[model samples]
Target: MLRKIESKNMGSSNLGWLRSKFHFSFAEYYNPDNINFGVLRVINDDLIQSNTGFDTHPHRDMEIVSYVIDGELTHGDSMGNKNTITRGHVQYMSAGTGVYHSEHNLGEDTARLLQIWIYPDKKGYEPNYGDYRFNWKDRENKWLHMVSSKDGDAPIKINQDVNIYSLELRKGEEISFPVKEGRQAYLVQIEGNSLINEIELNERDGMEIVEEDILIKGKETSHILILEMSKED
Candidate 1:
């Protein structure tokens, strides 16, 4: 089955310098019905004003992924690693036992991105960090695996039975995948328009798919993120 989570239906919060939309219950946006779908626990669309961002915070027992859409984001963590994440770049932080990190907008314009959190298959693993640049040209009209179980393939590795795909499609482009039977998936449109099994989705729009044999089609020049997850029986 397919269900649409309209952009307007998302929970929002405006904290002056930071404006965020939560696709699932996050922070103060609590909803028992929308806690999560499969192992995908959090999908937060964040737009940070220039010269502002999130301060050092602690996280544990979760796999966090950040995708920068525009401008620059400077990341620094307790692991003694610091880096800049720009458009088309992804940063992953495996908060196994515990970790503290901060993100700052390093551009004059607003920095937009999606910060997603997933429940790991096992906890108390060693914390780690990784960042990589993904070429849009290589993924044109195709799905690029941006995150996976193993490292060196997608730059970022997480401890979960999940894979994340980033796709940039032309107006008439399309793609299909035979998902594992009995698993679930979540699609988040970061920009432009697209259609999943003919269901229209705009910017910041999301959907939870419980059906198998998924076919994703884009209706325009669009940027989309798909998280394929393994469901627990």
Candidate 2:
């Protein structure tokens, strides 16, 4: 069955400098029924105005992934790592024990991004950081595996058994992937509209899918994030 989490129902925080939408109970937003889906804990879509951002914050026992949609985001962490994440970049920080980090919009225009958190499978491990840039042209027409536990071509590593894919589909394009025998997945439409398993989803809409094989067909030029997970069962 397909169930959608509409954009209007998502918790929102509107500051003069930033606008955010929370997919799960986060910070001051609390919804018992919307706490999380499987190991996926948080999905925050943030648009930060120029010269504004999130200050240094602490996190532990969580895997944080950031995907920038527009402009640039400057990141600095306790690990002595600092970098600017732009469009088509994936940044992963494993705050296993504890870590402090801050993100800011460094561009003249607003910066938009998706910040996702997944509960790590292990606990008390050392904190770590990683990042990679994928040329949009190479992966634009298909699904690109950006994060996973597998050791092959995946760029980001996580302390969990999960796979994350980003796709930029032109109108009329379609994609499909199989869920492991007992696994589940999440389909998040980042932009435009799409149909997954016959269910229509607009921008910022999401679904927790637990069925076997999954198919996605884009109704318009679209960008989507798919997280294939093992903890849903």
**Leading candidate by lDDT:** 2
Per-residue lDDT of model 1, residues 80-175, tens digit only: 989998987899999999999999997899999999999988889899998998886877888888888763366567898788988888888788
Q: How many residue pairs clash in each candidate?
A: 0, 0
Residue 171 local lDDT, model 1: 84
- Model 1 CA deviation exceeding 4 Å by range: 151-153
Off by over 4 Å in 2: 150-153
If scored against the real structure, what TM-score would every candidate get? 0.95, 0.95
- lDDT against the true structure, per candidate, is 0.86, 0.87
Tens-digit lDDT track for model 2 on 1-233?
A: 45788888899998889899998998889998888888999999999999989899999999999999999989899999999989979889999999999989979999999999999988997999888888898668788989997453577889888899998988888888776667888888999998888788999988877765778888998899889887465
Candidate 1 residue pairs that clash: none
Provide the global lDDT of candidate 2 against the true structure.
Answer: 0.87
